[model samples]
Every structure is written in structure tokens, then in C-alpha cells.
Target: MDRISDFILPAVIICIVGYGFIKKAPVFDLFLEGAKEGLCTSVQILPALVALMTAVGMIKASGALDSFTYALRPVAALLHLPQEVLPLALLRPISGSGALVIFQDILRQYGPDSLIGRIASVMQGSTETTFYTIAVYYGATKVQKTRHTLPAALTADLVGFLMSALAVRLLLP
Candidate 1:
């Protein structure tokens, strides 16, 4: 298993180069071109990434997450979900890093094996960073409008968040 893991990348590269040679393709040049395109895409997404990071930082610094968690206490209790996991559930769709901070905090405060910690972990894994994803993908592609994508992604994240909480409560002790 260790040997296979070590050799997997080289093996895949050799296979790809061999296939390219058989097909009379310019493998090295193609690889270089792909690298250039990837760099360009990274450059295009950089500003969006900076903006997102800045926004997340401000929200965190402003204590909005804490306030939001406080406000959601009623709903969380009604749903039989932990109020401590509310930050993770809310921030997971908007920003992964923000959600991770909350998730880690939960784990630190509650211990990984605790029920709230388990629920937070499950919520983090199941949800997607919807806005961050759209920002990066659309920014890289220069898409002018995202037409219904936000709603769909948010809906999926919401469903995933609810299901994750439900499953964790049902499955874990």
C-alpha cells in the first residue's frame, strides 16, 4: 500500500505521456500550456478570494456570528439541534474557513467525542461553501450573471445541513 501510494503519481504521469506519444500529441508543450491556463485562472480568482476573505474576517471581527447564534437559539431548540452548532451551519455555506474556525472552536470547547462536536463535524462535512464556490468559479470564468445558481446551491446546503444534524442525532450516542 505504501509502495502503491508512492508510485501512483509517477505511474499516472507515465501512462498519460505514453498515451500522448501514441496519439502523436505534444505532451510537454500541452502540459506547459495547461499550467499556464491554470496560473491564469488562479490569477483571475485571486481578487475574488481576497474579497471573500476580507468579508469573512469582518463578519468574524464584528461578532455577527455570535449574535446570529444567539438569535437562532429558539429555532435550534425547536429543531432539537445544538445552538453551539449554529455558527457552523450558517457559515458553512458562505465561507468554509469561517465555518472551520467555528467548527474547531466547538470541538475545542466540547471535545470531539461530545454530541455537539459530532454534530458540528457532520455539518461541516456535509455542507458546501456555496458563495465562495460561486465567487471563484464565476470569477475565473468571467461569468456576468449566475441566474438561479445561488438559490440551488443554498437549498442543497440547507438540506444537507438539516440531514447531517438529523443523522448525527439518530446515529450517535
Candidate 2:
């Protein structure tokens, strides 16, 4: 299985190049064009990315995240969520890397086999970086108004967080 998986990518690449050759396509030129377009898209989204990152940094540095987490503790407790993982749950939607750092801290402090660690791990897997994703993709597409995307995506993230905890509780011994 491992050997087959290893060859899968090379096989796909070879097939693509072969097909291009058989069709007399300018594969290299096409590749270069695609790369250039990708670079342009990256450039277009750079400002959004920068703004999102700056906001995340400011929220963290100003202790807003911690305060928010603290404020949410009662709600988390009401929902039967582990208090320690609240920071991760809050951060997951905003920034994946930031959530990952908190997830890592949870794992190190609680150990992966522990219930809080399991819940955090499940959350990290299930949730999306909602704001970052919206900023990049919408920014690249020059979308000024995100009519329903924000609310829908946030609802999905909320479900993911709730289900992550519920799943860990129900499925794990």
C-alpha cells in the first residue's frame, strides 16, 4: 500500500505529461502560464491576508482573546465543554495557525490520550479557519459583499465545535 501510494503521484504526473505530448500541447508553456496566474492571484490576496494576520495579532496581544474566552466559560460549561479547550475552540475559526498553537499546548499539557486533548484534537480537525478562508478566497475574487457566506460558514464552524466535543464524549472510552 505504501509503495503504491508513493508511485501514485509520479504515475499521475507521467500520465498528464504523456497526454499533453500526444495532444501536441505546449505543456511547459501552459505550466508557466498557470504558475503566473497563481502568482497574480496570490498578489491580489496579499492585502487581505496581511489585514487578517494583523487583526489576529492585535486580538491576541491586546488580551481580547483571553477575555473573550473567559467570558465564554459559562456558556462552555453550560454546553459541557472542557474549559481548557475553549481558547482553541474560539481561535479555530479565526486563524488555523493560532488554533494549532493552542491545540499543541493542550496536547502537551494534557497529553493526547486525555479527554481534553481528544476533544481539542477533534476540534482542530473538524473546524475551518473561517475568517482567513473568507478573506483570501473572497479577496482573490474581488468580492466586496459576502451576502450569506459569513453567517453560513460561522454556523458550520459552531456545529463543528459542538460536534467535536460531543463525538469525543460519545465515541471514546
Candidate 3:
């Protein structure tokens, strides 16, 4: 234990000193600059957050989500997937709130202990917020075309969806 403590204490001290000396002034300034940018960024994104939430609310208010889920039933059946997971797949790549709603619906329909519910929960954890990704990328790059973006994004989204299901089945009881 004493040997372990001696080695660990010196290693920690060396790492701290190394980083402090190497980084120096730039690191502190960078951290402060990042914090300031993040603050301004939060304010800038407020409008976007409202718009996204309102749009998602309207979409959910409409009956479109039900039909969308229904349309995917055949595909899910063919894939031997649980019906409970269909809504999550459809919503996951579009909007975070929409995806959460679908995730909650899956939990409600399948129960938390069920395979589909576990898979949906895992899917939520593993994947990023897709709409947020596109928004950030487009916002930063100012690309307006939106051509080929959906398909490319969907490819990754689908993989995340399938991977979550497979992972839950393979890993969880």
C-alpha cells in the first residue's frame, strides 16, 4: 500500500506540473474564452430551442406521428423487431423531444423489463440528438441545400437503432 501510494502521489504530482507548465497562460485564457462563448451561445440558441419545441409540439399534436408509426409496422415485423420500438426508430433522428415521447411510449407499452424497452433506453443513451447535430452543423457551416443530408444522417441513426437492439439482447438479461 505504501509503495502504491508513493508511486501514485508522484505520478499525480508530475502530471499536474507537466500540464500546468506546458499549457500555462493559454489554457486559462482558453477556458475563460470557452465559458464566455458558451454563455453567449446559450442566449443565441434560445430562439432555436423555442422554435424546435413548438414545431415538435405541433407535430405531436397532429395525428401524423400515429400514422408514421403505423407505416413502419410492416418493416418492424419483417425485421422481427418489437412493435414498441418502431416509434422510437422513426422519432430518434428527427427531434429529441419527439424521440423522448416515443421512448416513453415504448416504456409504457413494453414495460421497463421488456426487451424492447431496454433496447429503446439503450438506444437513447448511445445515440446523439440528431436534430441538434444537423442544426449545429448547418448553423456553423451555413449550408442551406439540405440535400443528401437526411439519408446520410439516417444511415447512422438506423445503425444506432439496430446496434442498441442487438446490444441489449446480447448483453442484458
Best by lDDT: 2
Please, what are the lDDT tens digits per residue for candidate 1 over residues 1-173?
Answer: 99989999999999999999999999989999999999988999999889987887788789887898898899989888878788888788777777787888999999988988888888887777888888898888767788999888888987887787789878986
Alpha-carbon RMSD, each predicted model: 2.9, 2.4, 6.6
Better of 1 and 3 by TM-score: 1
Tell me the spans in candidate 2 whose CA falls farther than 4 Å from its real position: 1-24
Following a full C-alpha superposition, what root-mean-square deviation does model 3 have from the true structure? Answer: 6.6
* Global lDDT of model 3: 0.77
TM-score winner between candidates 2 and 3: 2
* Per-residue lDDT of 25 in model 3: 51
lDDT string for model 2 (148-171, tens) is: 999999999988988988999899
Query: Stretches of candidate 1 above 4 Å error?
Result: 1-24
TM-score, per-candidate, Cα-based: 0.83, 0.89, 0.69
lDDT (C-alpha) at residue 99 in model 2: 86
TM-score-best of 1 and 2: 2
